[model samples]
Each structure stands twice: as structure tokens, then as C-alpha cells.
Target: MENQEQKKRDTNKIYFLIAVIVALLGTNMYLYFQKNKSDQRIVTVSDEKTALQTELEKLETELDQANNSTTELSTELKTKDDELKAKIAQLKTALNKGTLTAGELAKAKEDVKQLRYFVGKYTADIDDLMKKNAALTGERDSLKTTVSNVKQLADNLSKVNDSLYTKVKAGAALKTSQIQIGAFKIRNSGKETDVTRASTAQKIKVMFTVANNPIAEKGSHDIYMRVLDPAGNLIIGEGGSFTANDQDLQYTYKTAIEFNGDAKTFTLDWTNRNNFEIGTYSVILYADGYTMGRGSFSLR
Candidate 1:
């Protein structure tokens, strides 16, 4: 009986040893599996964080590029840009943490997705603004060109009118022709006789016919006469001054004639206070700021 009891006790010890070994193996296996799952979670979180960080940086770069465009942003657009930048900054701060819980990571993912949508909308808004600006610029340029063309056309018309006025003014002047000069002597009885001798001459007579010009000014027209001696010196008679060919000139005689737009002949007489010279004399007539006609007579 002692030998049998001892064998049974040895068998119970082996079975307990086997159960303990099996329990230890099961506990170790469970610990190993749990550790492996934790490592994978950590790696996944790290990779996700890195990807989010990369995306945030890319969004920031795009924002900066949009700001660098040539078009100036409106006040509202600038505010939106600032808000987006702040959002990026906030996201970056969140992603910079060393560790993230699953809930936090999932929240970050949602935020990033929303950020992408907002960024796409922002870019679309910028494109629309740029297109509008381009169209406005084109319209402004076209308006300027139209204004310039109109101004040029007005200037051209003004020049043409001025030219026509100048021509019309020039065409309205009166013309004189058939000028004749005669010398005469007045006897003591007050009778006149034609004479050629300078010493015997006491009066000078001038005759001319005016052309019919309907455009010329009607009414009484003042006529001025200038007499030049053989030496080319002007003979001062009345010492009256008149303007002719843009020059102030002294006249020897002046008279008035009535003009009614009909061809007419007129005569004038002048008695010199000084003695006449024995040479050729030149007589020029002026009317309305123009030289009318010239004539010559000899005196002896």
C-alpha cells in the first residue's frame, strides 16, 4: 500500500507541472499579441500624422502662391485668406503633438477633409475674381481708345472749319482795276486844264473802276491813296495813318465811295501843298486792308 500511494503522488506532481507550464505559455502568448497590436497602432498614427502634416504644408504653399498673384485682393478676400491661414496653423499645431488617440486622429482626418474643401472653394473664388478683373481691364482700355478717337475726330473737324473760314475771309476782299492818273492845272479863273509839266500842275486826278463782288462788304468804303516820288519816298499830304497788309502806313489822300455790289467807276482829286518834281510818280490805292491797284504818271 505505501508503494502504490507514492506512485500516485508522483503522477499528481507531473500533472500540476504540466498545467503550470501551459498556463505560463498562454499568458506569454496573450502579452505578445497585445504588444504587437499597440506597435501597429503607433506606426499607423505616426504615418497618418506625417501625411496630415504634409497636406497642411501643401495647403499653406498654395495659399501663399495665391497671395503672390498680381491681382490685388479685395478686403473680403484678404479676410478669407487670413482665416484659411489661421486654420492651417491650427491644424499644424494639432498634428504636431507627439501622440494622438484614435478619436483625435479621426477628428483630425475630418478637419483635413473640410480644409481641402474650403481650399478648393477659395481657389475657385480667386479664379472668378481674376477673370472679372481681366474683363474690366479690357473694357477700360476700349473706352479710352474710343475717347481718344473721338477727340482726334473733333480736332480734325475744327481744323477743317478753320481752313474754310480762312478761305472765305480771303475771298471777300474787293478788287480795283482800270486805274488812271492825270495831272491838271487850275487857271486863275478856277478852270482846270490837262497839263504834264510839273511846275504848271496844280492838281492831281485819280480814276479807277471797282469790280462787282457780292461777297464784299457793302456800304461806304474808305479808300486810301499813297503817292511815291521818283526817289521812292512817300509824299506826306494829310499825314493820316491807315493799316494795310498788316502795316501802319501814312496816306496822302483818303476818300469814301458807296458800293452796292455793282461795277462802278470813281474819281478823286488832290492838290499838293508842295511843288511837284520833274520825274515819274507812282500812285497806289488801298481799301479794306488790301492794296487795290497801282498807276504811274510823269511830271515835268
Candidate 2:
């Protein structure tokens, strides 16, 4: 009985030792698994941080490429670019840490996702702006070309008008022909008779015919006659200075006649206050700022 009791006590002691050993082994396994789980969590957080940082770097590179692609940016676009860069910088600052909790890593992932959306939107906006600017530039260039063409056409038309005006002005000048002069003697009855003797001549009769022109001005025309004596001096009466052939010329007599672009004959009688000289006298007709015709007569 005593041996049996001692053996039972030894068996109980062995069972207690076995139970303690099993508990210790289970505790060690729990600690090792906990440590491994902690290491895996740290590695996951670090990998997430590296991924977030890489995404941010890519975003930054994309932004730089966008900025370099265009010639100029609008004020609004520049402001947006600055805001995106600042946001990326802030996110990078947060991600640059050596470690991150699960919550922090999740927040970082969400932030990067939102940043990607914003980057896409920004790039699309830039493309749209570039397209709009290209369209505007094309329109401006086309407008300039149209204006230039219109100006060139106007200049050509002006030149043509000037040439036509010059031609018309030249075509509207008057001319005279068939100019003749005769010395006449008038009695108290005022009936003139032809005479060659200087003493017998009381007046000189001048006749001329104006040529017809289709383009001449149809109005009352003032005819100017200049009588030059044998001494090459103008026989001035109640005449004034008139411009003819770009010259300030003194005329002897002036008369008015209605002209309708038809050949017309005119006669003028001039009576000198003094006796006629026995020499040749010249007569010139001027009208419309030009010399028309000339004639000469001699008295014995």
C-alpha cells in the first residue's frame, strides 16, 4: 500500500511537470508568432510608404512635364499648378517618415488616390487650354490675313481711281481752232468793213471756233483774249490776271459763252483808243487754264 501511494505521488508529480512544460512551450509559440506578426506589419507599412512616395514622385514628374510642354499658362492654371505642387510637397513630408501606423498608411493611400485624380484633371485641363489657345491663334492669324488682303485690295482700287481721275481731268480740257483776225473800219452806222490801211481801220475783228469734246465741262465758259502789239506788249484794257498753263497771265478782254460740248464759233471786236500802228498784231485765246489758239493780222 505504501509503495502504491509513493508511485501515485510520483506520477502526479510527472503530470504536473508535463503540464508546466506544455504551458511553457505554448507561451513561447505565442510570443514567436506575435513577434513575426509585428515584423510583417512593419514591413507592410514601410512598403506602403515607399509606394506612396513613388507615386508622389511620379506625380511631380508629370507636373513638371506639363509645365514644360506649353509656351504660356493662364493665371488660373499657374495657381492650380502651384497648389498641386504644394499638396504634393506636404504629402511627401508626411510620407518621408521611416515608419507609419496602419491608420496613417491608409490615410496616405487615400491621399495619393485623390492626388492621382487631381493630376489627371489637371493634365486634361492643360490639354484643353492648349487646344483652345491653338484655335484662337489660328483665328487671329486668319483675321490678320483677311485684313491684309482687304487693305491690299483697297490700295489697288485707290490707285485705279487716281489713274481714272487723272485721265478724266486731262480729257476735260478745251481746245480752239480756226482762229482769224481782220482789220475793219466802222462808220457812224456801226457797220464794219474790212480794211488794210492802218489809218482807216477803226477796230479789229477776231473770230475763232472752239472744238467739240465729249468729256468737256458743260457750263458757261469764260474766254480770255490777249492782244499783243507790234512791240510785244500786251494791249491791256479792263482785263485782270488769270492763271493759264500754270502761268499768271494778263489778258486783254474776257467774254462768257454757254458751251454744251459742241463746236461753236465766236467773234470779238476790239476798238483801240489810239490810232492803229502800221505793224503786225498778235492775238491769243486762253480758256480753262490753257492756251486755246492764236492769230495775227497786219496793217499797212
Candidate 3:
């Protein structure tokens, strides 16, 4: 009986120890499963965060490009505004000068419309300014032409008046006389004599008579005579004044006569200072500052 009791106690102790070991193994398996689940969740979250950051960076780069395009467009618009203002100023000046025409204004307005169409969204004031400039140019050209014609007409009238004044200053009516001369002769105390025996240094007497006519004015008039030598050369010395027919006159080897109101006979003598040559000699006569006649003679 004692041996059997001891064997039963040993079997009970072995069963207790096996139950303890099974409990410890179940705890360890639970811990390992929980740790593996936590690690998998962490890896998934990290991948999602990386993808989101990359997407955000791409969006920011696109936004920056859009901003740059907006800035460039704004600058271009401001430059166009300045150019439009300058053109408007020029148009205003042309209008004030009265050089703008209606047709040109219409054409310029059409051009402005085309420009605005290209710009997509422009103002109306620039078109109006272009029309005004065109009108001004046309008016200025017309006025210049009118002024030029007026000046030309005035100049022509002035020239015509000067010509008329010149014609009036010249006198209208006049009278003239005819004169004649003949060969030299000698006179012996109022008796006519031939001059064939005269020496080279002897004085030659010339006689002439005037006949009154309607063309000649009846008044005391000064006469001038020019005597030429046989070689058709004038024979007067320098600084000599001779008296003929009661007229004080300067002679280039010639005679002068003072005529009364009636036809009269005149006589004068010239003292020859040189020898005669065998050629024809001539005399020209002037009366009342006009040439009257000419005559010729032969000398041996």
C-alpha cells in the first residue's frame, strides 16, 4: 500500500508541469503576431506620405509658371497704353491746325479698329484721335495751295503796273529836221569864189541853208557837226571849243549852228592844221540832240 501511493503522486506532478509549459508558449505567439502587424502599417504610411510630397511639389512648379506668364502679359499691356497716348497727342495737334479731312478721318478710324481687333480688348478714344490727325493734314495742304496762288497773282499785278508806269514816263510827240553839207568854197568880202588854189593850211569855208517844214519845230535849237578826214577819221584836237553861226560849241573838227524860228542861211570856216589827203571826207550833223543828216566830199 505504501508503494502504490507514492507512484500516484509522481503522476500528478508531471501533468501540472505540462499545463504550465503550454500556457507560456501561447503568450509568446500572441506577442510576435502583434509586432509584425505594427511594422506593416508603418511601411504603408511612409509610402503614402512620399507620394503626397511629390504631387505637392509638381503643383507649386505649375503655379510659378502661370504667375510668370501673367507678369509678361501685364508688361506688354502697359507699353501698348503708352504708345496709344502718344498717338493721341499727335492727333490733337493736327486737329487744332485745321489739317484734318473727313475721308482721312474715316480711314484712320478703320485702321484703329483693326488695331484694336488685333489687341483683343482696346479702347475707343485712340480711333477718334487717328481720324482727327488725317483731317488736319488735308486742310493744311489746301490752305497752302490757296496762299501760293494769291502770292503769284499779286506779283503779276505789280509787274503790270510797273510796265504801265514806265510807258507813261516816256514822252509821246516829237519833231525832227534834215540837214545837208557840200564841198568847201572861198569868199572874198561876201563874193563867192572857187577853192581850187587853196593851200593845205588855208581855211575852208562851208555854207548851208535850212528849209522850214512841218516836222521841224520853230524854235532856237543847237546844232552839232562832226567832220571826218579823208581816211574817215575825226580831225578834232583835244580841249578845243569853236564858235559857229553864233553858237558856242565844242568841236571834234566840226561846226555848230544856232537856228532862229525861221529858215536861215549859215556860214562857217575851219582852219586846216594838216595837209589834205586824196580821199573822200564826210560830215555828220545833229540838231535838237538828234542826228539830222550826213554829207560827203572828195579832196585831191
Candidate 4:
């Protein structure tokens, strides 16, 4: 009877130990699974952060390029560029906090996508303007050379003529080699705009370059211009007068330009209070009793 009692106590103790071991195994398994799930979440968040950082690097590179050329940047475009930098900084701050939920992460990615689109469009606009400026530079260079050649030809012709011609040419003649005239309207924003409408025209711009001459007098020469309407009536300027072509002529306007014989470009602005007619108008430039160059333009 004592042996039977001892066997029962030993069996109860063994069953209790086996139950403790089973409980320990089940707890360990559950903890391992939970730890692995948490690690996977960390890895996923880290991957997304890395991707966002890479995108930010690309954006910074583009912005650096724009800032380097900021002098040539338009005011409106420069403002947009500054706004983009602020957005990038904000996004980086959020990502660094390590507290973003899945939904917030997704929202950040969408914002990045929109920013990239904006960058692409801005770059395209800048490229287009660069191309236009390049073309204008090329044309201006060609115009300068052509004007120089015209003056050279006139000097050569004078040398081959009679003594009277040579004597007349000895007097320094301020010669214009190129003439460009355009009718423009000033916008409310204070920008000059070329317009086809005659009534809307507020200003006429004249551009020319004086020719280089070793013998030409290097002094202040009064350059005069005559703007004749399509009907052949002279559109007088605000002030000044000069004689040309064996007649006492009252010039429309005149400016005293100091000539040192090196060819240089000049700009003349005319604000015509009188209305413009819808027809071709002629512009004649004169200096020192000599016709410098001629240009013409039409308005609709």
C-alpha cells in the first residue's frame, strides 16, 4: 500500500513537470513569431525612407543648377524654385521623425511625385528661353559686322572720287552702318511689347551702330532722326533742329553722342503723342550733314 501511494505522488509530479515544459515551448514560439513580425515592419519602413532620400538627392541636384543660374532667372520662376526647397525640407523632417504611418508615407510619396512634375515643367520653360536668347545674340553680332562694312565701302568710294569729294570726306562724318526700327507698346507691367496695332503703339525704338573711322572726328556729334509718315509728312520730335541737304531743317529730335571712332550700338526712344497711321513709315538717320542709314517699318 505504501508503494502504491509513492507511485501516485511521483506520477503527479512528472505530469506537472511535463505540463510546465509544454507551456514554456508554446510561449517561446509565440514570442519568436511576434519578434520576427516587428523586425519585418522596421525593414519596410527603412526601405521607404531610403527611397525617399534618394529622390530628395535628385531634387537637390536640379535645384542647385537653377540657383547657379539665378541671375538669368525670371522673378516668377525663381519664386517657384524657392517654394520647392521649402517643401523638400518639410518632407525630410517628417521622414526623419520615424513616426510616419503607412497612410502618411503614401501621402508623402504622392507629394514627391507632384514636385517632380513641377520641376520637369520649369526646366522645359528655362530651356526654351535659353534658345531664344541665343538666337538674338547671333543676329545682333551679324548686324554689327554688316554696319561696319557699309561705312568702309563709303570711305573707299570717297577716296576714289574727285578732289571735292575727298575734301568733303576729310570732314569727320558720323556714319551709321546699321539701322533697326520697331514700333512697340508698353504694357502695364512696364515691359516693351511689339504690337501690330497702330493705335495701341506708344513708342518707337531705333537702334543703330556708329562705324569706326580713323579719320572721323572723335567729338560729340548731334545725331538726328526724321520719321516720315506713310503720307510723307514728317512726324516731328519733342525738340532740337539741324540743317541737312542744303536746307534749314528742324529735326524731329537730336541727341549728342560722343564718338571715339570705335563702332558701338546706340538706342533712341521716341514717344509719339500723335497717333500712328496704318501704313509703312520711313526712318532716316543723319549726323554732320550726312545721311547715316535708313530703316522702315509698317503698322496695321
Candidate 5:
């Protein structure tokens, strides 16, 4: 009976010990499973956080891209451009927060939406400004063209007035007729007599009759004479020059005449410095840029 009892006690003790070991193993498994569950929960939260960070970064990059065009706004819109840049900076700050809840992220997304809308409206405003600027430029160009045309018209009218004045002045000039030149022989006593022989000539006489013109100016006019030798060379006296109708001519002699619009005869003389040539010599008279008379004389 004692042995049986002892065997029973030993079996009971082994069973109890096995039950305790089994209970301990159960507790360990429960704790391990709890730890694993907690770890998995943490990993899931981290993934959500990573996704939020990625989304925030993407939204920030998009906002930056959208705001980059603000620099293109004109000076008049600089205030609006600055405001938009500030809004973009605010969005970036919100996205960069260390701990962002779902509600906060949702609010940030809402803000991003508002920013996108703002950017769209700003773009529209910029478009409107550009259109207005183009219209103003066109108007300015049209005004310039109109001003240039007006100036050209005024210049043309001025040119026409000048031409009419020139024509009127030319028409009012005095005329002359019956021009004659005579070669003369000079006596030792300074008396000149008409002669045509080269050996006997010592003086030249020029005579003309002024024609009556009702419009001629009543003034004293200086007449210039050109004497050309047979070789078409000028027989210049004292050096003198005058410009006539954009042409300059050298004169050999000059005389002053008074014009009162009445036809009158006049005579002038040139003393010979050398003996007369054997060919024909020419004489032309000019006054006030007008050819008063022309004549030629021959000597042998």
C-alpha cells in the first residue's frame, strides 16, 4: 500500500510539474503574440506616416511649380505676385510639420486645392492684363502713324509754299533787250571811237535797253558782265563772284543800274588791257540772277 501511494504521489507531482510548465509556455506565447501584434501595428502606422510625407512632398513640389510663374507679372501686379508667393510658403510650412494628423493633412490638402484655384485665377488675370497691354500698344502705334502722316503733310505744304514763292520771285524779275557790243579804238586823249579792226581796238562798249515789266522790283541792281575770249576763256578783271540759281559764276566787270519799271537805254565800257584778238569775243550780262542781255563782237 505504501509503494502504491508513493508511486501515486510521484505521478501526481510529475503531472503537476508538467501542467505548470504548460501554463508557463502558454503565458510566454501570449506575451510573444502580443508583442508581435504591437510591432505590426507600429509598422502599419509608420507606412501611413511615410505615405503622408510622400504626399506632402508631392503637393509642395506641385505648389512650387505653380507659383514659379509669379515672377512674370508686371510691376503693377507685384503686390498680388508677392501675396501668391507668401501663400506658397505657407503651404510648404504646413506640409513640413513633424507630426501631421489625418485631419491636419486633409486641411492641408484643402488648402492646396484653394491654392490651385488661386493660381488659376491669377493666370486668368495675367492673361487679361496681357490682352490689355497688347491693345494699348496697338493704339500707341496707330497714334504714332497718325502723327507721322500729319508731319509729312505739313512738310509737303511747306515745300509747296516755298516753290510758289520761288516761282513768283522769278516771274517778277526785270528783263532786257537790244543788246549790242562794239569794239572801239581809243585816241591818246582817252576818246573811244567805234572800230572792228583788232589792231585799232583799245576799248569795248556794251549797250542795252531795259524792258518794261509792271511787276519788276523798284531797286538799285548791280549787273555783272562776263567777257569770254575766242578760246572760251574768261577775260577776268578784278576778282568777283556771285551765285545764281545754285550756280556760281565769276564776273569780269560790274555796273549799278536803277530800275523804276520803265524801259530805258544804257551803255557801259571796259578798257582793254591787251591788244584785241583776231577771233569773235562774247559778252554776257547778269543782274539778280537774271540774264539781262548777251552780245558778241568780231575783230580782225
Candidate 6:
């Protein structure tokens, strides 16, 4: 009986040892599976992070490209705006002058249309540019109107000749005795006649014969005489007669003589208040405010 009991106890001990070994192996297997699962989760998270970083880099590149394109487009638009403004100015100048033909007007209108289209197409925030363009358009239109009015005035003046009614006849050839420095044709008529120097009281005589010129109209034309000293200074005072061809019209000078289709001699006497200088004096004759003829005489 004692031997059987001892064998039973040894069998129980062997069974217990086998069970402990199996439990330790199972624990090790479970720990290995858990560590593998943690490592796989870490690898998946790393792969997801790499994909997100690549997507962000692509987005940034696209944004940079978009900004560059915007800048280039803005620059191009500004250049186009400047070109359009210059074209508009030229067009306005041509249009208002009335000198532009039909074809040119049509072309300018088309250009203006094109400019308007371009301005309308601007997508950027260009309020200042739009305002400037509007101002330029207004200025161009104003200048066009002004030039058009000037052209009309010039055209009207081209149709009529107003200078014909103011015409006058030519005068006669002047004579030497008419410009004599002393009394009329008499030796020592007043004093010794000195062409070089004369007292302020001496009288100078002038004579001229009118010539039959077709330019001399039959109207009663006024005559003007301008006397000049040697230095070309006017000897006449400023308060001379201001009458011309017709008594109705008052000009710088006047003389009423009927032109009877013949030449006539006229004599004029100038009494001097200032001493005559030793030089040539010039006399200019005018009819109806038109210079008819000129004559000169030496005093010295």
C-alpha cells in the first residue's frame, strides 16, 4: 500500500510541471502577437503622415503658380491700358479737327470700342484705373468738340473774300519841287533855301501826280500821308486824322478825292515846328488804309 501512494504523488507532480510549462509558452506567444500589432500600427501612421506632407507640397506649388500667373496678367493688362489711352488721345484729336475722312472716323470708333471692351474685361480691383480712363474719355471728347468748332469757323471764312471791299487806287508819281525845302519856286522867298538845315518855321512842299491804275476803285477813297525823319521816326504827331475811303468809316488816315479815270497832280505843304535834320526823309501815301505809293527826299 505504501509504494502505491508514493507513485501516485510523483505522477501528480509531473502533471503540474507540464501544465506550468504550457502556460509560460502561451504567455510568450500572446506577448509576441501584441508587439507585432503595435509595430504595424506605427508603420501605418508613418505612411499616412508622408502622404499628407506630399499633398501639402503640391498645394503650395499650385498656389505659387497661380500667384505668378496673376502677376503676369496684371502687368499685361496695365500695358494694354497705357496703349489704349494713347490711341484714344490721337483719335480724339483727329475727330474734332473735321479733317478726318469717313474711313478714319470709322477706324477711330472701332478703336474706341476695342478700348471699352478691354476696360470692361478687367477683372482685377482697378477702381482707380477705371476712374482715370473715364476722365481721359471726357477730356478727349471735349477737345474733339473744340477742334470741330475751329474747323467750322475756318471753313466758313474760306467761302468769302472780305478784303475786296476795302480796296483803293494807286497814287501819282511824286515830283522834286513838291519836296522842295524852301518857299514855292522863289529865290529867297522867305530865307536862303538850305536842304541841309532849315529853321523850324520853314515850310516844305510836296507834289505828286496820280496814275490811272485799275486797282484804284471809283469810290471816294481817303488818303494818308506818313512823314518820316532820317532815322525812320514819324514826324507827324499822334493826333492826326483818322479817316479812310468812306466818311462812314474812320481809319488811320483819310483823303476824299474823286477818281475820274485820269491822273491828277496834288501838292501838300508841311510847316515845320522842329528844325530839319541833315538826312533823307520818307513820305508814304495811303488810300483807303492801303499803301498806294512811297517817295523820299534828302534834306542834307
Model 1: per-residue lDDT, tens digit, 171-284? Answer: 666678588899999998999999999999878999899988898888998999999998999999999999987799999999999998788999999998888999999999
Error of 5 at 215 (Å): 3.7
Which segments of candidate 4 are over 4 A away from where they belong? Answer: 1-16, 157-300
- Sorting all predicted structures by TM-score, with the top scorer first, yields 1, 5, 2, 4, 6, 3
Q: Which residue pairs show collisions in model 1?
A: 198-300
List where candidate 3 sits over 4 angstroms from the true fold. Answer: 1-192, 197-201, 205-218, 237-268
| Every candidate's lDDT | 0.90, 0.88, 0.54, 0.84, 0.79, 0.56
TM-score of model 1 (CA atoms):
0.79
Global CA lDDT of candidate 5, please?
0.79
Question: What's the residue-level lDDT of 286 in candidate 2?
Answer: 84
- Per TM-score, the best of the predicted structures is 1
- Model 5 TM-score? 0.66
Candidate 6, 20-121: lDDT as tens digits: 999999999999999999899667655544543343344334333433442333586667556655655565555456244456545655665565565445
- Model with the higher TM-score, candidate 1 or 3: 1
Per-residue CA lDDT of model 5 for 164-201, tens digit only, reads: 98888776666676898899887888777888788888
C-alpha TM-scores of all predictions? 0.79, 0.63, 0.35, 0.48, 0.66, 0.36
Candidate 2 stretches with Cα past 4 Å from truth are 1-47, 68-79, 177-207, 224-255, 267-286, 289-300
Residue range 253-285, candidate 2, lDDT tens digits? 888777899999988878887788889999998
- Which has the higher TM-score value, candidate number 2 or candidate number 5? 5
Q: In candidate 4, which residue pairs clash?
A: none
In candidate 1, which residue ranges exceed 4 Å CA deviation? 1-30, 183-187, 192-203, 228-253, 270-282, 296-300
**Model 6 bad stretches (over 4 Å):** 1-158, 163-201, 214-219, 241-255
lDDT of 4 by residue, 1-300 (tens): 999999999999999999999999999999999999999998998898889978987987887775675348789878988888888888888888857888889988998888888887877777776777788888898898888898898887766676566456645677778888899999889999988789888889999998887778787888888889999889877656777755677667677788898998899988888899999999988887878888999999
